[model samples]
Target: MANSDNNNKTAWQMATQVIHAGSGHDDPHGALAAPLYQTSTFKFANTEQGSARFAGEEGGYIYSRLGNPTTHELETRVAVLEGYDAAAATATGMGAIAATTMAFVKAGDHIVVSDAIYGCSFALFSELFERFGVHADFVDLTDADALTTALKDNTRLVFLESPANPHLKLVDIEAVSQILAGRDIKLIVDNTFMTPLLQQPKQLGADLVIHSATKFLNGHGDVVAGIVCGSADDIALIKGTTLKDMGATISPHDAWLILRGLKTLDVRMQRHCENAEKVADFLHKHSLVRKVYYPGLAEHPNHSLIGTQMRHAGAVIAFELDGDEAQSRYFLNQLQMIPLAVSLGDAETLIQHPASMTHSPYTPEARQKAGISDTLVRIAVGLEAAQDIIADLSQALQSSQQRWQRSA
Candidate 1:
């Protein structure tokens, strides 16, 4: 049976628990925060005790790579927040994805995934996993029929990312979960875009939820971490095999940083949503913007579904400009406040061109099919004042329009 102390907590309760949960009171030295266990190996109490630990008869740390007190606290906090029985922390987001996928599939198994996942993740599946003899099918996640059609007899996993990176496309978690119910296939969702405060996939019937904690979960963008949350049995299965073999364990210092970020996640998420809404509204009204993709907007194709599934529209927003690569470059160069960078989910605003940046590895046709157009620009709205963000975007758009007129 699962431990009783961590059960029956609601999402709000879990958020509060994140502030004070997991080994805060265990230190005999009366330290308030969990200290980092930086040692490579732990000192065994005795030969019998060490044997017991190795044999799984006792629960204690054997090595920092396998486990650590600080990392365990971060895992426990993430599991509680995500409404899962347990969680495992990894060195990076890709580590979590690779570890989980490796744990669940074998040579003859097949996988189905959303076409609009993070570019790195897409490459990992298409290039690396395919080379390993594991077949993968990618389909537009918004089309339920396509997902169903992609599933095969040997399909062992279905991966999705709601409000997918760069495009901000929405996928109905509950709808997908219902479709895969009672099947051998496990539903794995990349919940990095929408942290636990905004959306909990497990509660909606997903078998597993993964996060690139470097994003919203860490909030500060200082540490790179990943988490996989699910039932105890599934967690133990991955922890015992894939995680142990892959050796992608998160460092104690990084875990501590992530824990610090989690303390104010609720407040940070609210501001991110608010600022993103304002930015989306500004972009929608701009003359240079051909299309704006944001769930908060009523015109979005999945707005209604997003309303039902997500607590908020989220911080990331994407829009297409009227011109080609030249114009897009001019616009990005004109921007003063927003930094031109690849990664998102930071305290300061960031902007990137997906066609030439994050999604550049994919073929042009593949990128277009995934809604990553040559003119597409993605904005990760930060904690900055909404008015200032809008003003900065206005100047950039105006500059792009003037440049386009000159070129024409």
Candidate 2:
């Protein structure tokens, strides 16, 4: 399959390709799976051939860091799924983001980004990009007008995360695209929350789509990987310049793990959506809950926009409790089934207190403005039975309420 030209295949057909796309006929020794080409360098047929490969006159692997048959297969599959001309795999999700950002923008250029992005991403834009003479402004992504207003003459990129981390805030991708349609700006969306099965950002006019494959793409919390999908020109530039110079490339073994994970993504996402809806419904009806933040809920502020942009509501849900930090901590400590941990989109349920755990880096005023209150708790619903998840949450809430009353 590594030798096959996949230019003609449709998207659904590409999912099938995920399993069989990367490997050539098995070795005569009968190895069924794609073997990890684990070496750093590849032997050249001749010096002339190597020169042609290096000069872009031909296509072939020269180094594992540059490209490998196994990683190439994952790249092709992700590209097709994302409806892009090409894709590149990275060692981690941050690697993908950094490579994509560095490829397009440089010193003196400005970036407009969502304020509620992954905490680390926010730190990068705020603390690091400034040191390199690249300026970034963070705004509430849900407000398209604010994003447009924040753009400057030097603004070269707009970075956003929809159904943003922990809070579940939705951004209007199409609206943002329309605002930038005639501008020189490129729109980059971190699509880790929705995956390509639910949201194809490129089809909606994004210039680039990135993912932390450690989440839903891997589906089992096993591998740390990232992917960037976009036009062939964009991918070629990043691959040739940023990726080559930075050396943050995905391992063949990790790529193979992602490939195996991709085979089950469709089915797992279905269950994740179904279970998340049930859990959200439960949270909405609880007496101690102040607000439930899941797009599947009609009361969600961006429900209509989400319906237009995404295939379904994603698995993450956040709710605010009736009290403060102590109440939130009590609930977290009472959970029996859901693990109190960070990182989402896994096989087992996980929960965290965003004000303390995920978004703790933000100043109090910043967290409050982003709606991450001291009482907010976020849940990443998994394949657990809905009844069981709800039951555990109910008990936790009950304990929290009692603790709050005792403290008062």
Candidate 3:
């Protein structure tokens, strides 16, 4: 996790890094992938080594909570990809956000958050942190004026998510970083939607990058894990305190599953983008669809940032049907291929109505201002053939039209 010259020498291109970053599998059995060291504790050579490990005098792990080899490998690879000095793995994406934010704040601290984010993330601030004497303000990150008015003297952290959940809104990272350059605020960006492979938030001036490894990072949607990447000092603080005290460490087996997933991230993302582009076009042209919100579309407000900050338009698509919530539910029921599911970034297509499902955690007023209408449908396009995805959606759109065609 050191950012010294020795580490720089090992730095490789991202494709190579995913395969070889900090990978020293010295297992006596010579297994190919990282072996699962699925125990709760590690043994030392002697009592002296244990004392040194505890005192930070030695470099060996004393317990799984402090460190684990398999998890460390995943952390190292993701940190390298994120262009950070180190990383910490957690039980879930929320765990990563909690550990990172809790490490930097306490009672009497104030934080600024994006107006629209993943529902659980909103809950993390409103339901959990606010009860503990911390204060948070949700503001529109796309507007410079809003960002200016939200900053306070006690502001300790500024959290955001670009191409925010359920909506495709862009926050200019460089512009915002310059605004807080002289302040002591830490900018935390949830980079779950755009993996570091697509967008490098560190290069754009973020203090820390958080990810729900359950999403694009794992690509296959088999494991639920989280990672926070930043400087060695910052990562060490979370590992030593928040992660240990909160007991949100990821299991070694899940870490290994995610590690396997990372190896193919680049190719999987390429296919995801390819499939999303075609699906967006189909939705945009459909008579029953009102508006499509994928960044790949030229009409998107943040379309230009896709090529500038990210490698491509991601696989998530948000659109409103020309119907009410009940008609939207009818459309979901008529779908033949895409599953009506909550979580995204799976190998198979998944769809959900956010206003009633994912983003329901937000108050009605908050959800309305964020533009998550009751008829809004969020689709996580998968690796299915473009024709298959389009065909499934087309039939559902037709059914929805028949079910809701009236008065309008």
Candidate 4:
């Protein structure tokens, strides 16, 4: 279904779009739910029709790998939500990053990346892509001068994640976009942390926006999917090349799950924001907490960018303990409610140590440079009652302090 014509014309708000952006989907049974096209291939009426589809002269799908109605619906819904011309869904968040970057970069190309990023992303740029001859410069995007200095004549992309993973360091998107404005270099933003509900990077001059739909987009932590939104021509190129050849296509079932999850995205995001704000305030006031890194805090370094870059500080919070690594580990173990795990934006609150877990791919020196301390803990606040979450954290903190004090 997705009535492309109507979606293009109507300027639906976020709440409306999340539920019905891909409405007008044609269903033979006229089911209330979007039809899940779960097959691996599609049937063509005739040889001529198949030839036309293969030759790009016709519009129907020939193979699920190449295209699927359910996946396309997810793409359309996300594209409309992000205010982009088109979008492509990938098997994983890393797939979206790889496909989008590989579709554009060549052997001799260079990319500038934010100093602080997801562990796998860092490994992709520093370890994998480097072997293939593409190089990247990891710099603190917060410093405009550093970004300016890092740009090269062969720079093809400037990649960054605002409110970056594990640390909550924010970059000025509009400023970075302006820096790359007249250049051929494209600005790619990982909007996984702040979903379209909180921030839309494309609206602020980014050429392409990427999301780990597995996180906030699905909001259920059930599907591991990714999305990249950009101009139609760019999406077509990505679809025709990297996605098609690299084989990182998403499953129809996963796409369908995401579509279902999108229905409650508005409410989920609102609750996430509200819960995170309260949790952050509690942590900031707690004596056992060292440094709290959440944009919601007025004292945060990037607090000024809150209204301009993002609607709110978002659901993830990164903070360090007053003690060292042992205390951090003990505190995480002492938590009874919040699960110690990786991945964010889930309905259940999750916490993890970045240095040894998510950002383990980075060397100690690299982590230090990126501002990921050994004791830093990241918490993805969930829909749990604020008071309950606070009480759990409070007990864990108190217990951690007492145990560490006794050992000392």
Best by lDDT: 4
Q: What does the lDDT read for residue 18 in candidate 4?
A: 94
Across residues 71-101, which tens digit of lDDT does each residue of candidate 3 receive? 9999999998999999999999999999999
Top candidate, metric TM-score: 4
- Return the TM-score for each candidate structure: 0.95, 0.93, 0.95, 0.96
Local accuracy of candidate 2 as per-residue lDDT tens digits, 221-334: 889999999999999999999998999899999998988898888778878989998899989999999889998899988898654577788899988887777777888999
Better of 1 and 4 by lDDT: 4
What's the TM for model 3? 0.95
Please provide, for model 1 over 284-372, each residue's C-alpha lDDT reduced to its tens digit, 9 standing for 90 to 100. 98888889999889998888765357777789999988778778888999999889997778999999988888888778888978878
Q: How many residue pairs clash in each candidate?
A: 0, 0, 0, 1
Tens-place lDDT digits, model 4, residues 93-204:
9999999998888898899999999999999999888998999999988898999999999999999999899899999999999899899999999999988877889878
* Model 3 misplaced stretches (Cα beyond 4 Å): 1-12, 405-408
C-alpha lDDT score of every prediction, in listed order? 0.86, 0.86, 0.87, 0.91
Model 3 lDDT, residue 98, Cα: 97
Which of the two, 2 or 3, has more TM-score?
A: 3
Model 3 Cα RMSD, 1 decimal? 4.1
Order of models, best lDDT first:
4, 3, 1, 2
Off by over 4 Å in 1: 1-14, 23-25
